[model samples]
Target: MTSLSSEMSEPGANPLDTVERLALANDWAFHRQSDDELAAEIAGQWCNYKLWFSWHPELGVMQLSCALDIKVPAKKREKSYTLLALANEKLWVGHFDIWSEEAVPVFRHALLFRDGNNASIELMEDLIDIAVTECERFYPAFQFVFWGGKEPHEAIVAAMLETEGEA
Candidate 1:
């Protein structure tokens, strides 16, 4: 399978540009990919994004299926499992996702970077970063992340980049 991974950062992942979750977002794009050509090229299915809270404290990490209940702010707490595509792809995430009725595991990995999808992961990351940077300018509240792992969606969720806490 043509699998790949990438990291999305506002301002095209300059590395120099600093972005912190708690801090007010900067002027940037929110979408994961940018280039007009690339955007159009990815006409096929490419990415899926899921956001939630991790509940299994004993497990240390919670899976969406059995996430523990946490005090997710009524307004700020929400999640979605979006499949990234070309036609639907936007410069930004648009509106923040609304939480599901039940508590689910928090996003612990990058949005698109899975472990086995080496081919897809590499290519996708490049695109995701470009889009994400642009998204920041619009959606300052949304956070950019990758799919859990390279494992096909059928397999268990994995992590390209684990959502570790800030030190």
Candidate 2:
């Protein structure tokens, strides 16, 4: 059955609503946290992460934030910082960083529309896709740094290496 996914992709559609519909169609769990925000927990290949999206219609800007919840050991904080810096350099759309107060690393990206116009659903979907895909791709590097005692450069190289497998 053809879903309303195409219709929802039209410009001027509410990005948040589009996300909600897509999430349901994909059987993913999500919650509408507010008129302008939605939270989704995605179970990924390596691990799970909670993604929170905030959209400001007036400004036509959206921010997607995901908390990896992998705390950097106090002793390894410098390595964590180094890893993040290296990882971010390879990223074109989004970047990863540690939340200093909590020692939790977060992946964040922002989208801005020209002249305060609403974003098309396709753009919204693309934003979410990048967030999840990048997180899944590089999560293990964080693990290696925090747990496996791997050096930052080595961990990033391991993360950036493409593996052939079924998705």
| Candidate 1: tens digits of C-alpha lDDT, residues 74-100 | 433322234112112432432222235
Which portions of model 1 show Cα errors greater than 4 Å?
A: 1-96, 99-122, 141-167
Scored by lDDT, model 1 comes in at 0.26
Model 2 lDDT on a 0 to 1 scale: 0.79
**Candidate 2 lowest-lDDT run of ten:** 1-10
Clashes of each: 52, 0
Error of 2 at 135 (Å): 0.8
Q: lDDT of model 2 at residue 69? A: 53
Q: Give lDDT per model, in order.
A: 0.26, 0.79
**In model 2, what is the error at residue 147, expressed in angstroms?**
0.4
